[model samples]
Target: MYAAEEQAKGKPASVPRFSASRRNFLLKTGGISFASALVLAASGCTDNDAPNGGSLTPPNTTAIDLGSGDTGILNYAYALEQLEAAFYTQVIATPYSGISDAEKALLTDIRDHEVAHREFFKTALGSKAIVALKVNFSSINFSDRTSVLGTAKAFEDLGVSAYNGAGHLISSPDYLTLAGKIVSVEARHAAYIRDLITPGSFSSNVDSNGLDISAAPTDVLKTAQTFLTSKLDGSHLPS
Candidate 1:
């Protein structure tokens, strides 16, 4: 982990789907402000003014400080949850111009689910969870449907692979169960979005030679590098 940690830094690129059913809500095109509000609300990071480094403060300094072990793995999931929740929340608040009503409604469901999962980890990990990540999506064009869905496909598929690959390193039975629950949902999201991006994309990808396609933490973080602004430390995390 230390050797791998030293040689770090990059960026992640991908797409995600959008949804929600609110008429009163509004967001500027390409603005993540509304999504940030939703994340704060969901993560229970209220605006009443927090201390500089309370228990919720992210221990992560550079990406390398993210650590390995249960803590690192939890933070890894935390990072992904932050990314997904933000993506879907943005999608629903200000959907693509030509998106259908049904698509909007379904996307809303996905957004809520990601929020629930994001909050669940925050609650479960308590003081050990990482802070809300600062993501850069300048590469993704939220205004375009195809770009959005393509990114969604990448995020969902990567998420599934990450959870699958890391299952063995988890120490707590309870946490394993929780991770399983979350991964299953991620898998469903992956499958649905893959089909959306291309009619038969999921058919070959999910069951590709029964290969599982899970990824190592090193690979997962490497793949996710495009969007991350901070460094991930995997030292305390499990190998």
Candidate 2:
């Protein structure tokens, strides 16, 4: 139905597909995992300040403010997930030239996971969710493997750090717990992408204390704005 709709609109259907076995695996296990997270986030994890839901409103300006408090933090995350999901979706739809079966399978899995994360945040944010972001991917050469994976590596690393940086701002333990779970998955993705780029370099980003480096929201948003066509205002984000 989705493909047909796209065709009817004269747009090439861009849906990503995987082998039957992989599809079934996602339908079973992936569904359960994200579903549980969604329930938790929507039920008991919402911040008290955003009882009616956080607003993505930007003050009389073109830039979209992420809002303050935990709401801002979650929206910040939602924006990053949106970017990752868009990148991987494009990667799968147009596989890089010479992409091997193993690489294809791994990338496809990453794409699905990103889509799950994107949707989970959108649903959990409810009406407070920001508008779907417009991404600028002109810098990426999807036809080349190195270009694709390098961008993927950057995105995964940035995502992990973004979560780690913002985790301390969350006052609600439930919300903090959810962020921890999501960041751990992001770390796994960063490790996998790193190893793919340079064999046995998964731990390259760790500090002397054996901890991954974290970036403040201002820093993360500064880098993220490069790939986003929509202007993001992190000035109001919790200090």
Candidate 3:
């Protein structure tokens, strides 16, 4: 029925269906500003304010140091969480005109989770935490459903792979345990978004060995280059 409806409306068959119920849900939940108030309540960063107040528009820094050893790994994870949180913040702030309530809810949930993750790292790292990263979403078309969902899928998958790759690099058993827990959540996010884009595509990132792809810190930073405006100096991170 969804495919047929899209075809009738001249929309692509590939997109998710937005039924009447979804529209009604949007109207009902429209009063909630999950982007600001709700997210702050959900995140652990509520009490702690960074130099930039966790805003996206922070002063230009010469370079972001990821540090060395376990600290570097944590900073790397923190950086990725920051990027995810920032992206979802923008997604919720300026939702596509046609975005459905279901999309909004899912994206908002993701935003909250990312914010929580970001704060967790910041608190755990304490003085070792890197500055809040400045993101460049100029390449993203926020008003388009395809663009937003596609970008979300990319970030989710990248996050999962990043955790998987960085797991072995972490030396501390406690930090490794924490990373293990977070990676599972990231993988679930990846799967959920993939299904939203195309049903049953949850395993799209799986390789021939039936394992998710992993990347080095250098590789992960390179992939995230397009969305970041600040220069990241991950030179000291573990290989």
Best by TM-score: 2
Q: Write the per-residue lDDT of candidate 2 for residues 94-198, one digit (tens) a residue.
A: 999998897788778778778877877776676677889999999999999899999999999999999998888887777788788778878877887888889
Candidate 1 has its poorest 10 consecutive residues by lDDT at 9-18
TM-scores for every candidate against the unseen true structure: 0.71, 0.81, 0.74
TM-score ranking from best to worst? 2, 3, 1
Backbone collision count in every prediction?
A: 33, 0, 0
Candidate 1 has a TM-score of 0.71
- Per-model RMSD to reference: 13.6, 7.8, 14.5
lDDT of 1 by residue, 1-239 (tens): 43244225221111122334243221121123333332322332222321121112235545545434555666778888888898888888778778888667667767776876676556545565677888778888888999889888888888889899889877655556667767776776776677766777664564546654688776777767777775665544556
Better of 1 and 2 by TM-score: 2
Model 2 alpha-carbon drift over 4 Å, by segment:
1-31, 43-60
- Sort the predicted structures by lDDT, highest score first: 2, 3, 1
Writing each residue's lDDT as its tens digit, candidate 3 over 59-128 gives: 2457776666676677789899999999999999999779888778877777767876776666556566
For model 3, what is the alpha-carbon lDDT of residue 33? Answer: 25
Cand. 2 TM to true fold: 0.81
Off by over 4 Å in 1: 1-61, 207-211
Q: Predict model 3's lDDT versus the native.
A: 0.70
Q: Go through the candidates in order and give each one's C-alpha lDDT.
A: 0.63, 0.76, 0.70
Error of 1 at 200 (Å): 4.1
